[model samples]
Target: MPDQPFSLDQLRIVLIGTSHPGNIGAVARAMKNMGLADLALVAPRCEVQTSESISRASGADALLVGSSLHESLDDAVADATLVVGASARSRTLPWPMISPRQLGAALPAELSRPEARVALVFGREDAGLTNAELQRCHRHVHIPTNTEFSSLNLAAAVQVLSYECRLAWLDAGDTAPARQTAMAKGTAPAGEAPFGEAPFGVEWDNPPASHADLERYFAHLERVLVAIGFHDPERPRQLMARLRRLYLRARPDSLEISILRGILTAIEKHTGRR
Candidate 1:
């Protein structure tokens, strides 16, 4: 069988509390243009199953028809291994923020996992996501806009993010064919596709850790920090914030996470947290 790209399928475009069904349909169209299909709605303010949505969807009605709906953001992204929330404005408490391009670059490797599910979450049109909703995401993606009038429509944001993701997927598939051919010398037959070189053909032995795994790790880390008198829950400074930035920036795989947790356990043993 020919190699199929599962990473694209692993991505979910999640719309939360979308006030306009037309925007939902427009988003469906945008996702379709970029070879993305999975769509999830979280507590949509308007009835998504309406004629207005169907009209706006153009030929991407299948996405709208098959899209799943949930009561809350948690439920919408319950099965997602990586969740990235899209926001236009800065928040009071800074989350691990990245540009859409950065997110696009990272997703190809992340979705290489066997059962990885990535959710690109977008919030309501009026106010965007609440502080509580934004906290649920592992990373925050900011779409850079004009400083003076930065009001971006919901569907337009989806289109921009979707385009970036498509480009990233293409980059992941791109190989250095000329370099491989030069190295092959006389061994390679005429017209034969050059073998992928270096990082291009490497397989992941340990899949990237899921969001659930990270959540558990964070909980354990918090407990350990509290036990070691490093992070006092009462008078919490930027210790946890700095740690979150460090870990999220690293984006550790499963084996790495296991090693980290093991080290934490060793610390716990010394701290008498049996």
Candidate 2:
């Protein structure tokens, strides 16, 4: 437990079907790093307190001592009110996802609500939470990742979420909000200004694009739009805004956008050759 205790008494780190001893140990290290102390094991495939786990834990032995053993997940988090199942992809179970920041902001309210205890649940290394397992939790959390290659280590996921909860706990229950300043009348910046977006508005961090890339994207958009009958020479600007919106929505990753421009060049060549 942290000196100030940021979590509900029912807070538990439940690992289901964990097959690797080192991962369990790493999880202990991760939890301790973020000031979380409770751990629960559910149907683990290996010895939970092996030398590998202890060694990987680094210096989190105190938290490891109280690690609870459970034959099943239901026993592990049966008393928890808010159960967040960490996953990399969607499944049959429709668990709504909130980003780490959103989770941090919302968890304190959820944990403080009457009769609700918050618990963060992690799945095994080989396989994550099953539909049956996810149903036990009130909601699911998707860790956003590259769609093409979306895989993450189990312990790393625990580290991210535990950190979020700890932050939320600190922000919600802490009493010392204002600090004295050297000014005539002290006042702090509003709305946790430290985390807000750009004051003038977030422009392209990398200036909208050079003229060349912009023209290339326009040509690509024009080709695709004309092929789909979304554009006409008489009213070229009619679909310009809509085309821009498509690219904005796609957020066409660098590679995808580059490939799109290449195809546009190829198409222009073939059409002009006629």
Best by TM-score: 1
TM-score of 2: 0.60
- Write candidate 1's Cα lDDT for 159-195 as tens digits: 9999999887776556335434544664333342211
User: How many clashes (backbone atoms < 3 Å, residues ≥3 apart in a chain or on different chains) does model 1 have?
Assistant: 0
Give the TM-scores of the predictions, in the order they appear. Answer: 0.76, 0.60
What lDDT, from 0 to 1, does candidate 1 have?
A: 0.79
Query: Residue 191 lDDT in model 2?
Result: 37
lDDT of 2 by residue, 14-122 (tens): 8999998899999999988887887999998988888999999998866667899899876776556456677776664334566878877765434432344566888
lDDT accuracy of residue 81 in candidate 2: 41
